[model samples]
Target: MTLYGFRIPKFAALFFWIVVWEIVGQFELMLLFPPFTEVLAAMTDVVTTPSFVEAARITAYCYLVGLSLAVVAGIGLGLLMGLVPAADKLLNMWVNIFLSAPLSALVPVIMILFGMGEPTVIVTVFMFAVWIIALDTRAGVQHVSPSLKEMAFSFGASRVQRLKIVLLSALPEILAGIRLGVIRGVKGVVIGQLLVSIIGVGALFSLYSQNFLMGHFWALILILFAFALSLAELIGRLEQKVEYYAGARG
Candidate 1:
């Protein structure tokens, strides 16, 4: 693959990191960084365990629900703000504030409002994801050309028809936003469950950490990273498929 104009084999960088990790582990440089092989073995054990399966189920539930809510609400609000200048003016400030705010600080408030349960974790994921999506969707809509709207109107297109065309034109940006939001939602789920300290993958992390099971801890982390990366890559491919819509907007 080419990166920054440098050609390298697909797995070369990964192999290099694995070699470095093995060297570190062999020298006993740190108690926490286990060898690559051992970590892979631990991953096998983790995936087969009942606790891992249950934790994964819970995490997936919250992640999917939160992401679904974020996608719907973010798109709806974004369309409103984009099409209506008054709504844009009213919501833009708050959207920017939340987007820039340290959302971790709001976890306690969320817990208090929703209680220390799955709902709290789900809400946390929504909070982390919704703002970027809203902002991106709004930006995408604003970028849609005035001529397209006028053309549609001139063709006797109804309001709903105009909205459909505009949204399709914005699909690339919307997918990009959703991709980013999914990554953030992953973080939100981990943080929310960890703070609660008695549930799901977070509880497994806590258990592994307290017991100094470095292999298991890292394995769980790798699992979550793989899941997040896969989702982002899938959305990214979808964005590519819709690139024609950007030209349609013009």
Candidate 2:
């Protein structure tokens, strides 16, 4: 970032917001916001509680399982669509529709079908994440240079070899999609648990809200935000590392 033609640290904006939030919170400008210092203080107690430990475990399990399914299915579907015009014609409309749709409305339907359990939450996370991953993967695959494929063919590369080449070439976009999917998956997990209203971190959110424990509530939010940002930064670094593939293809 730059201000007045001077370079600013990347975290300057975040620090600025933190100061603003602290000021607003200290002055009781919002009923929902407690002092930021109190929220930070509550973080220790929140993390140490057995209830929070159990909630964290359940949230992690649901998130990882759901995201794993999304990655596999999304990549497979994307490859199919990218490699086969027929598949693209058949599925592209639906993919676009789901990608743009407000998926939260469908959560109730999922709950009805899967019942009020971990399965429903997992499905919610998957639904929130999969479409974008598929779309991005399809784009990556389609963007693979025709000459790369031709070269592979002229070299007597088998069908699997061609597919591997495409995947490697598309690694940058695939990782970008996964990084985005990871973020969406976090929202899914949180929304699923909140709507379920009886399990995981959602239950804790409910507990804090009903009792007006804003400090603990905000602390939990900060933890989730930190986790999501950390994951995104890690994936972004990986994306940077693979960017040479795109340049090579060009």
Candidate 3:
């Protein structure tokens, strides 16, 4: 970023917001918005607590499982849709609808079907993430060069071999979609756990918020935010690394 005549580091804006937050918090503009310093202090304490660790573990488990399912199912279904026009025509409308709809509205239905357990939370995350992945993957597959398919056929490639080649060719877009889907999955897991409210990070948030522990509440949020950002950053780097595949696709 740039000021009048100088450039600022990327994180400068974040620090600026932190300062503003501190000022508002110090002045007691809102009781819920505690000072950043207090939140940091609370974070230190929270990390050392056993309950926090357990909650974090549960959340992590749900996140990993949901993300894995989303990636596999999304890729498989997207490939099917892309390769088969009839399948695409039949499912495209539903995919678009789910992608644009307010998925949180389905939480109650999920709980009813899954009975408010870890399965429900995992399913919630899957619902939140799978559609975008499927869409992106399908688009990538559709865009694969016809010449490449013809070449594979001339070489007498099997169906699985053709798919392997296509997947490699479309890796860039696949990764891009997964990156976005991962971020959405984070939001999904949080929403699911919170809505279910029986155990995990959501329960901790409820306990802290209900007791007016603003610092702890904010600390927990910061932890989740940091974790999500870290995951996104890792995937982003992977995206950059595979960018060479873009040229190869041709």
Number of the top candidate by TM-score?
A: 2
Q: Report the lDDT tens digits of candidate 2 across residue range 1-250.
A: 7889999999899889988989999999998988889999999999999999999999999999999999999999999999999999999999999989999999999999999999999999999889989999999999999999999999999999989999999999999999999999999999999986469999999999999999999999999999988998999999999999896478
State every prediction's TM-score relative to the real structure: 0.95, 0.98, 0.97
True lDDT of residue 203, candidate 3: 90
Per-residue error at 90 for model 1, in Å? 1.9
In candidate 2, how many Å is residue 242 off?
1.3
**lDDT per residue (tens digit) for residues 1-250 in model 3:** 7899899899998999999999999999999999999999999998999998899899999989999999999998889899999999999999989999999999999999988789999999899999999999999898888888899999999999999989987888888889999999999999999987567899998999999999999999999889888888999999899887667557
Kindly give the stretch of ten consecutive residues in candidate 1 with the minimal lDDT sum: 194-203
lDDT value for candidate 2? 0.94
**lDDT of each structure?**
0.92, 0.94, 0.91
Each model's total of backbone clashes: 0, 0, 0
